[model samples]
Target: MLKSGFGPKALLSFACLMAPLSALAQDATSSSPATNEVIGLRANLSPADVRGPLNYEPTKGPLESFFPDCSVDKQMASELSEAFGEALISFDPENKEVRFGVAYKGLSGNAIMAHFHDGAPGVNGPVLQTICGHPPPTSAIGVSATAVMGDKCPVGNHGVLSGTWQLTDHDCPEGSDKSCISRTVDEQVQLLACGNLYVNIHTCLNQPGEVAGQITPVNWIGKEQNCNALPPKSSQ
Candidate 1:
């Protein structure tokens, strides 16, 4: 990744590194570029992409201290597994913030929380930021994470969450306990451009996630993003 205020040589290298970035797209993605005018990332949440975190069995910390497992009944599991959702993300270079919105339906229970996690396509990273930031006592109120944040998201089998993640002294958005990927907003945008960010929706039935999707840049979105917030090439 190009560091802030990098020189021309670094810019060239950054361009080269981005040449094959479309390789990041999964087979499910479209071969066609988006027809509309837009630059951002999109995630298609589904159960097939759902993966439980790596768990090692052996004497260690309390076994109870674990992520919610697939303990939902088979019938409900089948239905919830069919749940799907989407998350849209983009960055504002001027303000140094990440703007995102999430909508999902068919959850077995009300969403407990929703977060932006960092990791490779099939890997699991800790919560990078909380787009809908809610936890424990607050989440236990049985409302959607959006509602906990004072947003007007309807509850039940469907829900929506939206917020801006801006650079601040705190690791995460205020009121969240999740670990942040970076305190710098630029780094967070870099993560999105690199397809390292994902949205995960949590429910009491699926504590880790009821549905989730890897955030992928739309068309040349990532490749074209001036994440370094640099001036135009002509100006340089």
Candidate 2:
């Protein structure tokens, strides 16, 4: 059976109705510029803020570990809760490094092992750096010093830690009882430089690990070159 009385007029009306919806969809997608997906590391040591020494409060200063190009001015410390604070970072494709800044508050205890962890932001991944470690003088003070791991320095308590940190995939989880499982320091730094890891600070009470958070990157927009320069929305 062939029926054709409706004719071309009906088809013309249907085409017109569909045209606006298609054009609107195309315009929406075209209007917004897509942002590149950035890969990097960050940490929010909230729990550590309220757990440090009662008198040893965190001071605002320039942080270097998160990035070589950026200065951390808002780095905070605490020992009461696991939410110590956060760091803001930016990637420098030219120099193959990350620029960052931080501010911390509320420190209550002795600084323990701080390092970088590798994982997608906001997710619990793996270790990446040894910001603080035990070598040589195993005492609390000795290990806190900035000493390299060796027979003389031997992982100990008496040591120093440097705020300027570069993380690697191998430096993470800290060499096991058998052997270091992750990558090398250089590799970790390269990873961090390429935005593949985050920074985290730990305390003595929680030896193996403590509270942790993911590092996030934001666009640079300040002359002071500190965490304060970060956009207000960048902060968590």
Candidate 3:
């Protein structure tokens, strides 16, 4: 799997398996650059962008006011919760691009696909790129065919769900989507240029739309005004 869906326990277990970072740092000081690139979970928030404690803002539709507890952090092994979260999107300052990720667990079913839709943080938008496309599950509601970014849509569905049906230049073809290569680290930097891209997870139950909060840039590490003021949910 390109990315594993893990929870807090998995995060803790992985943390325990790795040597202390400090010890690793000492070992790296003597190694070549190829053996010592910086690595770990991080967000691109600035020192002042956040206000109160760390907070999440879901700006689009019914999710506007949704907020994740401030306690969630890189310590939790990728986002392993059902709430909205933030990450420091480090990218080329010149390009204004960065890759931001939002993870959600406990959706009605397995996450069959995910995307980085093109829209402002709080506003509605279209799917611009496919982030993850899992193979169909054998069980009921289990996904069968998955479409990746820049590929053709499956034989029968243009979208798993529908509403405004906002679409972008990169949506899959009418049908017959293809496998997607996970985004590369450098590509992550390129994807963040607009400072408006958000990460969304899609499950089999809500095929055409997101089942959780919309991913947005936090600018910093602290909380901001709540997003509970957006419009009512849209009807597809």
For each candidate in turn, the TM-score is: 0.57, 0.39, 0.35
lDDT of 2 by residue, 24-75 (tens): 3233332211232223333454543222221111233322332212121112
How many clashes (backbone atoms < 3 Å, residues ≥3 apart in a chain or on different chains) does model 1 have?
A: 0
Shift of residue 157 alpha carbon in model 1, Å: 1.7
Tell me how many clashing residue pairs each candidate has.
0, 76, 26
Q: Identify the superior model by lDDT, candidate 1 or candidate 2.
A: 1
Candidate lDDT (C-alpha), each: 0.51, 0.33, 0.31
Best by TM-score: 1
Model 3: per-residue Cα lDDT over 1-236, one tens digit each: 12222233423332332234224333433433233232222222221221221111122522212212112211332233232223322222333223222323333334445555434434434445545553222211112132333122221111221101112223233432222122333333333322334445543334344243333333321122223322222211
TM-score of decoy 1: 0.57
- Candidate 1 C-alpha error for residue 168, in Å: 3.8
